[model samples]
Target: MFIDSDIKEFVEALSSKEPVPGGGGAAALAGALGNALVSMVGNLTVGKEKYKDVEPEVIEILKKAKELQEKLLSLIDEDAQVFSKVAAAYKMPKNTEEEKAKKQEALNQALKDACKVPVEIMEYSLEAIKLQRRLAEIGSNLAISDVGVGALLLKAAVLSGKLNVYINLNSITDKEFVEETKERIEKISEDAEKLADEAYQIILQKLKIEK
Candidate 1:
């Protein structure tokens, strides 16, 4: 997983003619970054005299954001690994009837597993966006910009995740599964966009009317 590679190596891998750390991995990282920003806002709101009334609420949001962030961070690697598995399944031998059947089964299972990872990312990122909206309202005023950053990151996550969903949807042979997954992805995309827009507007309003 080479979790601690230097910036140069990571950038090289990301830019090199490789596809492992593609859209799915990027979406996972974006989602994690979004949660991280929300966590920062929540942490800054705690233990401040001016924000005492909202301290308890901020504490809860911080806890939840940290949990979500950890999950999403882990998914960054999981998404890449799942994609690699799908690629490997595609390389299965298909010479004989038995080999063809085995390849088909492997491809089907691999596609399903790959879809699950991005679907999970989409659901969690959607929740993170909702939390960012709430945090924008009661978080530290001084740190409202970070809430805006969270909203942006979540929007990136949503769009990036959609790309992963689109790519995986192509491999699915079951018509029902394809239709259902497409519907779910569409709904999530709409909701995530709306939430991100609302959060951004709130940030703008807060900054514009700052006393």
Candidate 2:
């Protein structure tokens, strides 16, 4: 699995011409790394006397972050799998009218299928961004910088996923599906942007970084 591979291997494959590990997979990885940081901050905060009053909340955030981390990681493989379908569809024979029709239909379906994993990645990254905002509020003070980094990564994931979705949508023929997916992307992207910025600002103020 791509997830099981080392970073160097994954990056090398990503940099290669092979299409399985593309932007969608990379987006999922970014979100997973962001959630990992969120979980780290929560782990550092929980079971600490300094944060006892908020330890319970931090524990809950930790659970959610871990869940998101797993989901995003799984999407790394899933994005690759679905995108393979897209690649296969693209290679379908289109020499004749009948073949052309079949190829177009297959490509449409493959594009739709390929969109699913990136959309899920964006949705999960939004949730992760929300968690980072809360974690930044109550997580270990020493790890606040991690929260900032997490927020930035999650934001990148969301935007990256957005681009992947749009690219697929451009080729999809079903206007209804395209419109609905675009609407969902708009809402999720907006919320992720806002929450990520809020979390970053909180981290900056906590660090007492001057504007």
Candidate 3:
């Protein structure tokens, strides 16, 4: 699996001309990395004597973070597969009227499916943002910075995922789908940025960093 591959191989694949491991996949992977950091902070908080009162809550957070991490990791491949289908649809022969119609139909559906991969990424990334907000409040003081970093990583995922969504949305002829998706993405991006920035500020305050 792509996720199982070493970092160097994965980076090479991402840098290659192949379209599968493109922006959508990269967004998912970034989100996964963010969630992993959240999980780390959660784990670090759960067994500490200083955090005993909140151990249960942190444990629950750890479980959720792990689940999100795995789901986002799987999404890396899912996004790639969806993009491959879209790419193949685009390459479909259009030599005749019937063939042209078929290609258009395939491309439309494939594009919509491609849009879905990034939509999932945006949704998952939002969840990561919200999760980070909680961790910033109760996570281990030593790893509070990780919670902030996680939030920023999720923000990157949300923004990059939106780029993938917008590109596909532009080619989609479904007016209702286009408008609804645009609205949702706009809200997600706004919420994500605000939450991430707030988390970072809170963490910096907690750590007494003047910067």
- Each prediction's number of clashing residue pairs: 0, 0, 0
Report per-prediction Cα RMSD to one decimal: 2.3, 1.0, 1.3
Q: What lDDT tens digits, residue by residue, belong to model 3 across residues 43-67?
A: 8888799999989988888778888
Tens-digit per-residue lDDT, 1-211, candidate 2? 9999999999999999988798999999999999899889988998889999998888889888888888999999999899888889999999999999999999999999988989999999999999899987888998999999999999999999999999999999999999999999999999999999999888889999985
What TM-score does candidate 1 reach? 0.92
Top candidate when judged by lDDT against the true structure: 2
TM-score of each: 0.92, 0.97, 0.95
Window of ten residues with lowest summed lDDT in model 3: 17-26
lDDT of 1 by residue, 65-153 (tens): 88898789888788888888889998999999999989888988888889888888888999899889998888899999999999999
Candidate 2 segments whose C-alpha is farther than 4 A from its true place: none
Candidate scoring better on lDDT of 2 and 3: 2
lDDT of each: 0.86, 0.93, 0.89
How much RMSD separates candidate 2 from the native structure? Answer: 1.0
